[model samples]
Target: MILALDVHYKDDGSAKSVGVLFNLKDSQPKEILVAYLEETDEYIPGEFYKRELLCLLKIVEKVSMHDLEAIVIDGYVYIDNEKRFGLGGYLWQTLNEQIPIIGVAKNFYHGNNETVKQIYRGKSKKPLYISSVGLELDTASDFITQMPGEFRIPHLLKQLDTITKEK
Candidate 1:
């Protein structure tokens, strides 16, 4: 089973952010994990990760690490060799290392668009970039493209996104 996770922030309030998880079996999602920030808490002392990371960790804790095949994260990673580790790094560190990881972001470093990226679902298409644990950029894109689904977005992640907010 493969897992796809994503986070989207609400502009009106920080508490409105949503975290999404998609459990895939045979290239199709069989489970979904949705985490949201309902209220802001006092900032935790950290330069890379903030209160948002705290809430995200709570969501990560819900997964049963044993059954997972690979975990697909929803954003970019800023690794600092000097810092030892930070929030983004910790999020994955908390997970079972037996399962591999992949991080997909809608937007990446500025001017990174030189690398062609496109998500095709029926007639609609969108651009995406992915940084995975063991896979290269080309391999990551190929993995997402091969996922069997009718939507441009992965079926599970898309479903969780809709459920997290009023639409």
Candidate 2:
């Protein structure tokens, strides 16, 4: 199974929603699911990080964390010991070999090389940033191509994000 996850937060830093696109089979469309915590506070740096971990843990516990293909997180992850920090890396460290994580971010600031990089909407624009962490898989471009929309956000995940704010 393939799990495509997009975690979105409010400007103030609260965890607004967590959109998930899952594929139980290889030759099938993805299933959309949204997990939202109604009562939450502003996303302070330390608080946000802790809450983020809790949110992910809750989602995993709600479902089956066994026999999973991948958990694709949307954000940056710095592996090297450089002067930088990453959102996904924190999760990776927390998971601590529990589950394999694949970081598929929209944009990248580091001047480095990636296994997968390509433009989504425009052909003239620079490629998007899609890298892996625990699981060494090359499905970055494939995920973007599978998204049923014309924007950076994926179709199922985007709807999940929108519905999360409806309340």
lDDT of each structure? Answer: 0.53, 0.55
Leading candidate by TM-score: 2
What is residue 74's positional error in candidate 2, in angstroms?
Answer: 1.9
Model 1 clash tally?
A: 0
Q: Summarize candidate 2's per-residue lDDT along 1-167 as a digit string, tens digits.
A: 55655555665545544545466333323555556665455557534455566666555555566746667666555433361335566766776766666665566555535443544653325455655556543554565556566566555545655655664
Tell me the lDDT of candidate 1: 0.53
Off by over 4 Å in 1: 7-29, 34-38, 41-49, 78-90, 96-98, 111-125, 135-138
Cα deviation at 87, candidate 2, in Å, is: 2.4
Query: Which lDDT tens digits does candidate 1 get at residues 59-149?
Result: 5667776766566665544332242333334555655345555655565445434332445554564655554444455766677766656
RMSD of each: 5.1, 4.3
